[model samples]
Target chain A: MKAVEVKHLYFRYSREWILEDVSLELEDKEFLAIIGPNGGGKTTFLRILLGFLKPTKGEVKIYNKPPNKASYLIGYVPQYTTFSTDIPIVVEDIVLQGRLRKGKFFYTKEDKKIAYEKMEILGILHLKDKKIKNLSGGERQKVLIARALSVEPKILIMDEPTSAIDIKGQNEILNLIESLELTRIVVSHDVKILFRKVDKIAYINKRAIIHEAPQLNIPKDRHFCEVELIDFLKGEECGI
Target chain B: MWDLINTSIYAGILLSIAIGIIGSLIVVNKATSITGSIAHGSFGGIGIGLYLGVSVIVSTLFFTILLAIVLGVVSLYFQDRKDSLIGVIWALGMSVGIIFLNLTSGYQADALSYLFGNILLVGDSDLKFMAITDLVLIFSIVFLYNRFLAMSYDIEFLRLRGINVSLLYFYFLILTSITIVMSVRAIGIILILALFTIPPLIAEKFTKKFYQTIILSSIIAFIFIASGILISYYYDLSPTPIIVLIASFGLFLSMLKRS
Candidate 1:
């Protein structure tokens, strides 16, 4: 079964179109990296997939169901930098938030067990008691990833997961993401993802171009500029 | 004198509970500006109540809840313009209150009481009402604690989790609106934001967990309120300003220590 299917999607905010007639598909357990420039509607497209915004025009489906209906199957990791640093919450609290289902007020023992298991999996069990603000950017991102994983989702979606981390941290996060067996969709501006084992790349700029990853032939030892990357994506046979 | 002192202390304790829970939320959510707008905007309802010769609480409750809903919508849909809109509502509310008071033919002495509360003047019925309000607020927070915390931490994540983020947001705003009304008699509109913000602001310095912040904030708020009441009683001065002044001093000290 396909993990995600977005067909002729269109989105806009007020006057200008943010996404235009974009479409893409992902098979189960596939890793897809979405790359785009600033104001390129990368984040806007993710919001639609999460069912936060209705597409102006088109259909978005996850596992053969609508985004809203398939919400339970998807775990979302939002940008760590987007939240306020002074929220006075520890890492444990944030991870527990993933277990938040409708009608459940308090965290059950089972929820705590699952949260702890995810924390351990991310090697952040010791840091669970640490405050979110006190953690390094890399650690904060890991905590967010753990939070997303605590849902035990079949699909994991991350937005700019490594944008705020150092290069070493970025590599570590990328490795961690690669290790996860779930179907993954990562939206990022970081060129470092090109070095990873992503199955496909979607370049979004008011529209989308989906390219198979192996065909790009990104050299491992050399640095890749964002502008050059966009040119490379455009040079490919990927369709818009 | 003894009765006045006792009643004021009781009011202070209740005030601490309300501000401790709601204030932590306000500070964490960065809704201080919106809350400030709502606090000031509630004055419009107070003025309308005065003009209509009806219960100020009822009129203020109706008006502020409506204002909260509007502000909530504006915050969601009009993110870029929310700051300016909040300012407009704040000024507009104060202006409408002043206009209504001016049009009213009475002495308007009670207007000062609403703007700057008299803790000593709190009667027995008012105490009962405050207790009831505190119970409701506590109940709501207890039942929806995780959702509220998630809302403050990352509203988008909560929405993706299938929670009705708007309804949760509106419910939060309504709680804030009611909290402001409950404090009007003890802290008043002009000085309420201080009590609503300062304790949590200070408590955040000492705690890393959300619930700890609330508990410590309640403790800190109680100390400020109790000391302010005591000092005001002895010095023959207004209690609310004294409370604000003491809380401000605490904030200053906390900042200094951090620096």
Candidate 2:
């Protein structure tokens, strides 16, 4: 069974259509990069897969179950813009929230150990005691990644993981995400950063088209630019 | 003097405990405006209690909780219009209270006491009610600390974790409403927001964690409450205004030091 399966998904916000006839499937442990322009329904597609929204038409299945039922197995790193740094929360406490269970008032020793283990894996264990607001953008991203991983999810999804950081921070985040041993799905606007790392690229406008990276015949030494890549994808859609 | 001192002390302890726990949630969740509305809107309940010959505290508790839930539901359904909705509720509540107070038989000599608290008027029953409120606030905070913290930071993330975010938020507002109403007897409806916000602001400066902020803010609240009571006793003034002034001064000093 595929790790994720979507067939003829359509989403509309009131009178306008946001996503139409979008469909894709992912194998176990595959890395899929979703690239699109701003407001091209990239984030909306991820939200649908995360069960934050339901498709207007068609169905989505994760590991043979609906997205909502399989949500526990899916680790999600929402866009950093959604986080509020004004709250007085430490790194450990924020990460420990991922382990929250119904009727559990206190964080058990096992829960703490798991949180620390995830932080250690993400190389952020040293920053566990630090305030979330005091961390740099890159450090905060890593902490968020550690928090997501603390759930022990089989699939990991990140929305715009590198959008708010500097170039070096972006590269570092992408490299870190590439090294993780889970089925990874990321939505990004920059295609160049993902070109060499992702197994497949799904170019999404209002629709989505999946292209296996190895079959594209793009030279490894060639530097890909965002404008060119966007045009290239648009041309592909036009079959020119 | 001895009776007055005892009353102030009891009121101080209860106020400090509620402000410490619920105050942190208020500041973190940024619910001060909604809390302010609840505090002011509670006057309507007091007016109803007076008109119906019911206990003011009990009636106010019911009224405040109902108002808080209404605000919560409105904000949940209409996110952008919450501020305007709160404004309408804020005005309507005070207006309703005035209408009810005017309709009640005879003149209420102590009606102004509810608007600006008169700690000297606090009887033994009021103290008992305040004590019970403090217990409920403390128990709820202790039992649901993790969930509360999670909800405050990110309600969406908490919901995605399979936690019932709406139910948690409703209970949070209920606790906040209780805190606001209970404090009204000591600090008055007009000045209670100072106590709810100032200590948490100062505590946020001193502590690195949410729980630490709660503990530190409670201690700060105690100091202000105690000092306010003593100052009012020495000068023969209203304790609510004095307490709010002290808290405001502390906040000013903290800001000066930060710059």
Candidate 3:
């Protein structure tokens, strides 16, 4: 089943055309990366898909329903820096935000168990009591990912998951998302950030350029703009 | 100084804490200035209540919510530009209040207590109302703490997860209105705006997270009220302004130190 669908979507933020005639779709369990330069409407595209942005023209559907209605089925971990970490929240509480899909503040026993299980999976169960401000960047990202996963949505979308983190944190997050079982669509300028894990790359500068199963055996010399190709990367690790 | 610190001063101290806690929450939630507008606009409710010969507290409770929700919804509807619109409502509300105060027969200046708060003058009934409002604020936050946090930190993420962020946003406005209505006594109509703003402004100097900001600001508010109560009682000054000014001073000092 296709988890995300956008057709002729056009969005303008106060006179700036962010997404123009952008249409794309992803089947269930597909890992897609949206690569673009800064301000190329990557965030805007994510917002439109999440129904946070109203397109001036076109339609967006997630899980067979309209974006807004179908949003509950979508999990999101927006850029971690968007929120201040100095909040006194614990990892457990942060993760619980993911369970928002369940639609209640007070969690049931089963909910509590599930939250803890997610925490354990993220390897931060022991940090449940620590304040968010005290955590390292990588740990914070993990906690955020755990929170997004708490809803157990079929489709997970992240915006710039590896942008500001150190190399180790970047690798951890890249590996973590790669290991996840859900369908994933991540946006990043760092092409190689998700290349190791993602099955395909949708090169988006102004428009999306799709590349199928870019494994090591693929003959990249055959297609794509020369300048668009990176210095060196092969197979699933596409132009790294 | 020792003799000035009496029983009433002690009561002032406790109320001051309440001020800071509420102030901090207001700042973190970006409801400070809006709450200020609501506090000022509430005079309209106070005026209508007085004119109608109804219980002022009841009127305030009802009107604040209606008005605050209106303010919240208006801002949210306008995509959070209700600040300018709220300014219009504030001025209009005050104008209406002044007109009603003048036209009403019994008490023209009797509404002075609401204009500039008298913390030392907070009666038992006012205290009771404050207590209830405090409890509600605490309860709502405790119950929906995670929801509120998620909404505050990452509203889009919450919306994506289908958390109904809009409803929660309104829920915050409702709680803010109720808090404003309750604390109308200590902060007065004029200085209540400060009580909703200054302490949090100061607290943010020391704390990063929303809850810490609330705690620190509450502590500061408590101190200011306690000191203001003593100073007001001895020097015969208006306690609300004094307390709010103290908080302002604290905020200034904190900012200075950070700078």
Candidate 4:
């Protein structure tokens, strides 16, 4: 079954078209990385896919259903900076929030077990009792990822999962995400790490162009520098 | 003296429940000024009630709920200018109340009580009303605890999970209005924000969980209210200011400890 299918999708904000004639499809458990320049509607496209926003034209289906109806099957890891650490919430409490369903007032024992199990998978069980404010940036990111995974979603979407962390932390997070076997959609700027990990790449600039990773001849061991990335994108722009 | 003490205790416990539950939400959501507007704006309803020969509490409840919905809608749409808009409503309600009271024929002998609270004058009927409000507040919290926690922490995430964020927010404002209006007779509208803010601020320092914060703040508020009543009794002063002063002192000490 196809995990995501976007057909002739068009989106606009105010007057300008943010996404134009965008069409794409992904099979189940396929890893897709979306890369683009800043304000190129990358985030907006993701928001539409998550049902946070609707496309101006055409249709988007997740597993043959509308995005909002399939929302429970989709796990989302938002940008870590979006959260405020001022609130007094513990790590376990945050992870348990993923288990929330409509009209369920209290967390059951099974929910607690799943929260702990997800934390254990992320190697954050030791930090379960600690408050969110006390964690480092990398640790907090992991906590967020664990929170997302606690829902046991069919598709995992992350928006710039490694934006603010150090390079080492970024590599660690990328490796962790690479290990997951779900249908993964990651929006990122770290092309070097992302290109190596993803099955396919979608270059978005007011539209989308999909390329299989093997066709690009990107070096396996060499680090992708900015100039090289720009040259590659420039080459692709020329229909090479 | 004993009768006064008994009344004070009952009112204190009841007010603490509202203060603790609603206060935590207000502080976490950063809705202090919105709640303040609701408290002051209900004065207009008090004036209307007096003029129309209706029950003041019922009228004030209606007015504040209306004001809460208005503020909720305004803030949801015009995020940047909400504070200024709330200030306008605050002044408008107080002014309208004064004008309506002026238009009434006889002197408003008990008008000052709503402005500053006269807990000493609380009757059996007031206590009964307070008890009912407390029960409603407690029941709402228990039934909606998880959703409230999610909403307070991250509303967008809750929305993504298919929860009705806007409807829940409206219900939240309604509950807040009811809590604020109920406390006006005991804590006074002018001094009620302190009761809603201070204990939570102090409790947050000692607790790392949401429920713990609510429970601890309620306990702290009860202690402050009890001690304030004792001090007022000894000095023959009003209990409202005394209670607020003790809470502010606790806030100060908490800040000092942090520093």
Candidate 5:
């Protein structure tokens, strides 16, 4: 089933048409990488998909429902995450926030247990009691991911989750997202490292061009005029 | 001399202690000028209080909440226009308050006290107000504490968790407004933000966590208030500015130490 559907979407900011008549049909549990040059509406389109902004025109449907009410099925992590470094809060409290929307049932022991379980999955369970400010940059991102997972979302949308982190941390987070068996839309600038983790690549430059079908062009260097995208793990479709 | 201290003194001491604790929170939240704006912007509410012969505390709360909602809406509407928009609202609210004071027939005494503050004039009723404000401040801080950190730290993540970022932002603004209104009588409208902000900033220099910063800042603020009051009582100086000056001096000292 299609997890996301966008039709005839249009958005403009300050005389620039960030997104124009863009449409997308995303499969469930698919790893989708959105790649584009700077100022290419990558962020704009991601935010639109996340329903943070109202479209200038047309429709965006997540799981065939309105995006505002469909938040339960989706999770979002933005690029800029550093804030109030001196707030003196532990990692567990930070992760618990992801479950805040479950009405009254969000605070159940099961929910808490599952949130803690995610900390173990993200390899930050040891840092659970540590204050967020005390954690390193990579560790903080791990906590953020653990927090995002506490919602039990089927769709994860990350806007440049690894932009500021080191390469190793980036690869680790990408692997973690891929292993979740959840649909993900990852927005990033680096294209080389993504060849294995992301099955489908959406090259967005004022618009989107998919490099999925059988094969994709791989450029030797990013500075080259032409970019590359190749099918990853298509031959070994792990039954995840 | 020691026998002069009892429930009122203890309550006064508690009052200062609570102010120091909550005051530190107020400052660390970076809502200082915003707190002052709420204090001064609430003059309109004070006018309403004096004109209708209601309690200034209640009136100030009403005005503070009203301005808070207005400030939240304005902040959202003019999200890009930072201080200028808030300044306009702040200026307008105080000027209208002055006009209202002028229109009132014989409420000048109440007007001056409310406009400037009369901490020395605090009696049983004032202490009672302080006690309640402190309770509310502490309770709200404890309850909304997690939300504050989440919104402050990773707003987008919180939003994805289905937390309405706008609602949290407005809720914080209302919290700040109430704190401002609460401090108005003790610290005066003009200097209330100093009590709310300065000590907390100085506290932030020494503390690492949100709670510690608030606690320490409030302690420092209370010390300033008490010492200033003590000095004014002994040496015949104005208490309000002295309190503010001490807090400011603490801030300078904190900065100098950091430097």
Candidate 6:
């Protein structure tokens, strides 16, 4: 079964359509990157996929189930900017929140063991007891990733995972994302991800155009910038 | 003097439980404005209760919860108009209360007590009610701890995790409204925000975890209230202002230390 299937999805906030008739599919374990200009409906598309916002029209199914039903199978890493660093929560608690499901009140010892395992994977086990306010931006991003990973999700979804980090931190996050083996969907504006062996690219701007990995004409072993990528995406031969 | 001290201590302990738990959430969730609005708006309930010759607690509980529900609905559904609407509700509730007090016959000494607080007037029945409120607050927090913690920063994450964010939020507001009403006699509406927010703010500085913050805030709030009561007894002053002043001083010192 496909990891995700979006059939003619449409969404709107007020009157004008934020997303219109967008459709795409991802095979199991497929890696997809969604890129678009600000307010170009990239986030909206992700929101609909995550079931935060229902599509105004059309259907979205994750592994043949609705987004809400398949929520347990999906791990989400929100944009770094969306969180307030001033919260007095420890890293362990934040990661443990990933284990939350219906009818479960307290975290069991087994849950703690899994949380530690995910933190260990993210190399943030040493930072478990530290407060979120005390962590660097990159460290905080890693915590969020660890929290998402703790869910043991079939699909890992991230929104602008490295947007707030420095260049070195961004590279670390990219490498980490590269190492993760899951059906991953990342919403990002960073062009470096294009070269990171992503399986496909979904360019969304009021409408969505899917480009399979083979269709991307990126030159290997040469540095590429965002403006150039946008130009390439807009080029008619690339099939916008 | 000993009986007054004992009563004030009991009130302080009960108030601290709420201050520590709900106050921590209030500060972390950035709900202080909404909490303040609910608190001040509860005056309308008190006034209506006095005017109708009903139990003030019952009237305030009904009024504040109704006001909080409306506030919660607006906050959840209307994103753009939240702040302006909160201001409107705050002023409207206070206005209604003042009008009701004006329309009532004779002197309205009860209005002063509700507005500014008179902890000395707390009776055995008041303590019983406060104990019940504390139980409700504790039970709700214990059961909803994980979700409420997540809701502090990321309601979307909780919603994605299959938690009903709106319903949880409504429940939180209702609990908050009840806690605020219960606290009115001990701290009054005007000063309640201080007791609800300042200790949590101070405790956040010294703690690394949310539960730690709540625990420390409860202890700190008790200290402030106890100290305020003792000082007020010696100086023959109102305990509410004394308590708030001490808490504020602690906050200032905390900020100074941090800076």
Q: For candidate 2, write residues A1-240 as lDDT tens digits.
A: 899999999999898889989888899888999888889999889998888899999999988889888878888888887868878889999899889876777888999999999999878899999998889888898888888898888999999888789998887788888888889999988765555567777888888878776666655677766677677766665321
TM-scores of chain A across candidates? 0.94, 0.94, 0.86, 0.94, 0.85, 0.96
Q: What's the best-to-worst order under lDDT?
A: 1, 6, 4, 2, 3, 5
Candidate 5 lDDT over B66-127, as tens digits, reads: 88888778766676875776787788779878887887787387576665564565666666
Clash count for candidate 1 is 0
Best by DockQ: 1
State which candidate has the highest lDDT: 1
- For candidate 6, give the docking quality class from DockQ: high
**lDDT, each prediction:** 0.90, 0.85, 0.73, 0.86, 0.71, 0.89
**Candidate 1 structure quality by residue, lDDT tens digits, A1-240:** 899999999998788899999999999999999998889999999989888789888999999999888888889998887778777889999999999998778999999999999999888999999988889999999999999999889999999999878988898889999998989999988777877999999988998989889877888877767687778886646553
- Output the lDDT of residue B182, model 2: 77
Q: What's the residue-level lDDT of B126 in candidate 5? A: 67
Let me know the DockQ for model 4: 0.66
TM-score of candidate 5 against the unseen true structure = 0.85
Clashing pairs in 1: none
Question: Residue-wise lDDT of candidate 6 within A1-240, one digit each (tens)?
Answer: 999999999899799999999999999988998888899999889888887789999999999999978999999999978778798889999999899988888999999999999999888999999988888999999999998998899999999998979999888888888888899999999877887878888889998878886678688777767687787775556653
Per-residue lDDT of B229 in model 4: 83
TM-score of each: 0.95, 0.96, 0.81, 0.95, 0.85, 0.97
Q: Which pairs of residues collide in model 5?
A: A217-A228, B20-B218, B25-B214
lDDT (Cα, tens digit) per residue for candidate 6, span B162-243: 8888999999999999999888887899988888999999999999888899999999999999999899888989999999
Better-scoring candidate (DockQ), 2 or 6: 6
Q: What are the per-model C-alpha RMSD values against the true structure?
A: 1.9, 1.8, 5.0, 1.9, 4.8, 1.5
- lDDT value, candidate 1, whole model: 0.90
Cα lDDT for residue B183, candidate 6: 86
Per-residue lDDT of candidate 2, residues B195-255 (tens digit): 8999999899878899899999999999999998888998999888888899999999988
Off by over 4 Å in 1: A14-16, A221-230, A238-240
